[model samples]
Target chain A: MEKIKSIIEVKNLNKSFGSNHVLRDFSMEVVPGESLVILGKSGSGKSVLIKCIINLIVPDSGEIYVLGQNIRELDQDQMDKLRAEVGFLFQSNALYDSMTVRQNLEFPLRRHWTKEMRDLNAQSAVKEALEDVGLGHTIDMMPAELSGGMRKRIALARTLILKPKVILYDEPTTGLDPITAREISELMLQVQEKYKASSIIISHDMNCIRMTSDRVIMLIDGRNYISDTYENLQNVPDPKVREFFD
Target chain B: MIHLIKIDSEFLREVGEIARFTGRFFSEVIKPKQEWEEFINQCFWIGFKTLTLVGITAFIMGLVMTIQSRPTLLEFGAVSMLPAMVSVSLVREIAPVITALICAGKIGSGIGAELGSMRVTEQIDAMEVSGTNPFKYLVVSRVLASTLMVPLLSSLAIAISLYGGYLGVNIRGNVSWHLYWLQSFGALGYGDFIPSLIKTFFFGFAIGIVGCYKGYNSKKGTEGVGRSATSAVIVASLVVFIIDLIAVQVTDLLGLT
Candidate 1:
């Protein structure tokens, strides 16, 4: 048995929107190269937790450490720099509608890579990322022209172009058909293995969670209610844990 | 009374937010990370693409003002006063404000809807998460474009309007193009040109600022996009009038009017 390094640690996070308390004393840790799924129904604060980890939404009270630096202590510049290492796939795909797929893929490189570097390697990087998602030919098409499955793949390709150490997927399979969902699930597995990337997937899709997540955390009532392997968690007789399996 | 208070509070909150948003724009715009490419593209869109609309509106306005004012001046046997009256009114007030109003409808709504759709669709978020400055790329470019274009548009508008008044003068009367030009130019003073031009920059700023704020702070889902676009035009239109009033007052105090 080998020891695994902790890539992300979230402890005692509390968030509220006026009267609506979203996350309460929620805590979790994600080890390096692991797939951890946060499963919650609508409005259960699963998305909020992922946002907090990425420094998008600040929690009312919490300690979040990413790659050993306390997120709260990082300045805006530091947070922005850290963002390049942590890829986030928004549920809506968020492909730049005004830009073509190649341009969208080039966006991060333009920001993070120097002009010379981008000029020299951007084309190759875009091609490789597109190839990773199996959509190499759709590079020049607009986001509007792409099918949902294709758009999602483009977004994944965009995220992968940066070769982010940790990928945060927010409802990656939410709006897809069952077949598409299964394909996306398989892609997530492939991404994990290929990139050797630690990932925090925020999802409610049973098939997605079952296939992609190595460990699942049930988020209910604004808390991390249960955390275990998929098969082991199914055996738990507790009603709260059983609710997910049943 | 309670409703009134609520409205007042909401207004104050929005004002505060706009101020903060403006501050953020300034900070990002000055930083080494600049979006000159996007800014130039926006300048072309906001300035060049808007030329036809502004020209048509300005032409109609100059002609209509000449026609409408002719009756009153004619009663006093002051038919020759037509060009001077229309010219002064158009250059000093009408052209700038009318063009601004048109921009409030056209540019303001366009920017609002574009950014609103981006916000709702999470393109803005994607930019941020990818470590790109959305404000710098989106807001600074558009605002700078509007601020620069308004004055140029107003100047173009004034020229076209004078031409329009010239055509109106010839419709029922014989005034040479030379005399019409002399009268129109003679009527415009340093006072009229400077004050009117300055105020338009503010109008441009107002339109750009209000539109961006509405769209950037839009709520979630499809309906939020509509709300963002509508509120952008409404608030921008209102702010144009308010800015015009303030500009007039300031010029009056300085004896520029």
Candidate 2:
């Protein structure tokens, strides 16, 4: 039997802002087709850890490997090329407020797809991605016009349009109502099932974690404290870990 | 004394950062895959949007200069030289500076607020994560548009100001439209028009750079956006005056005065 290789790896990551240490020698991995949730209290450096993986925030000293390439070694153009294969869903949903839904979906395609390729299949691609998120009717609406949940779906559709090998979700359900949050969680599962793309979801929503996570990593005190299946972690006797379950 | 030194060092640091920002703009501007469509869109907004304000202010300036200077010229029995005097002043100094200052207020604050909010909202980060160069797409396009448009706006303002001068002349005395324009053009040489027009490009660049710098580095969310917009206007307006003063001195040194 062959061992599965990790698709994303972070080793000895450390980051600081002024005197505040956010992430300290933290590390984690996501294997192919895995939904790994980073569960932590607010301001426990979960967001910082994921951002370091994507190189949004430069870690003080660490190695981040994504799809067999060391990201820090890549130049701007090379990093851009690598970025096309990794989709990031911002916590704010970060849709271009000035652009309509169709244009927002097409923004990433502008960089990754050739004009001829886009002309040939861009419409259908946009349509299919929107349909995957059940937002086919919002093809022309401005982001400001959409409800919060609809905006989140549109943002997810934009992420899915690239058919990336990995997706990073930053607090996907932070501001949504419980129903909407569950819907987004379900959408995340559907996206994973449909695309088979591995994901690192940063969330404290236990329901979302239970529904979407194959495994959960407890990020505590700027480090990866523990990793286990959600149910197994719920039964752990460690008080710090039990604090989360309780 | 230590506190004073810290303040001085902080100011110098800001200056150095702005110089670095300007250097990045130059470096990125010449790279291939230029965002021409966005540049044109910015040109329309930065140029066409500010035309009305610039034109109105210029017309008022020319009219006021003509009406007030009438008494001075009449004392010297040179009231006939009113058109030439007004044209030279407008072409050499007034129109470009005033138009640029107006843009510093309107367009500068606008770009600052727009980019600042986008920064706060993480749109810029999203652009970068999407494999797009946000600086090249946003900063270069806006800077280039303002650099090109300010001079064009000044040129338009000069023409409008001259027309207002003509109207002012006719309000109290008789000067034919043809003669008013003829006298206005006759007093102007390459030296007056070219130097003033050249200065406006710097004015535009300063405004664009300052606006972009403040916005791109904004923090603390909405309050930061407001601060960026306010400071962009203040710094851009000051830079316009400084650039104008330098242009005047340089032109004088070159004997273009």
* Each prediction's DockQ against the real complex: 0.80, 0.87
DockQ for model 2 equals 0.87
TM, every model: 0.97, 0.97
Calculate the i-RMS of every candidate, to one decimal place. Answer: 0.8, 0.6
Off by over 4 Å in 2: A1-4, B1-3
Candidate 2 chain B, run of 10 with poorest lDDT: B92-101
Stretches > 4 Å off in candidate 1: A1-4
**Consecutive 10-residue window with the lowest summed lDDT within model 1 chain B:** B25-34
Compose the digit string of candidate 2's lDDT tens values, residues A1-246: 455498899999999999999888988889999999999999999888878877888889989999888999999989999899899999999999989999999999998899999999899999999999999999999999999999999999999999999999999999999999999999999999999999999999999999999999999988899999999998999999999889
Question: What's the iRMSD of model 2?
Answer: 0.6
TM-score of 2: 0.97
lDDT of each: 0.91, 0.93
Tell me how far candidate 1 lies from the true structure as C-alpha RMSD in angstroms. 1.9
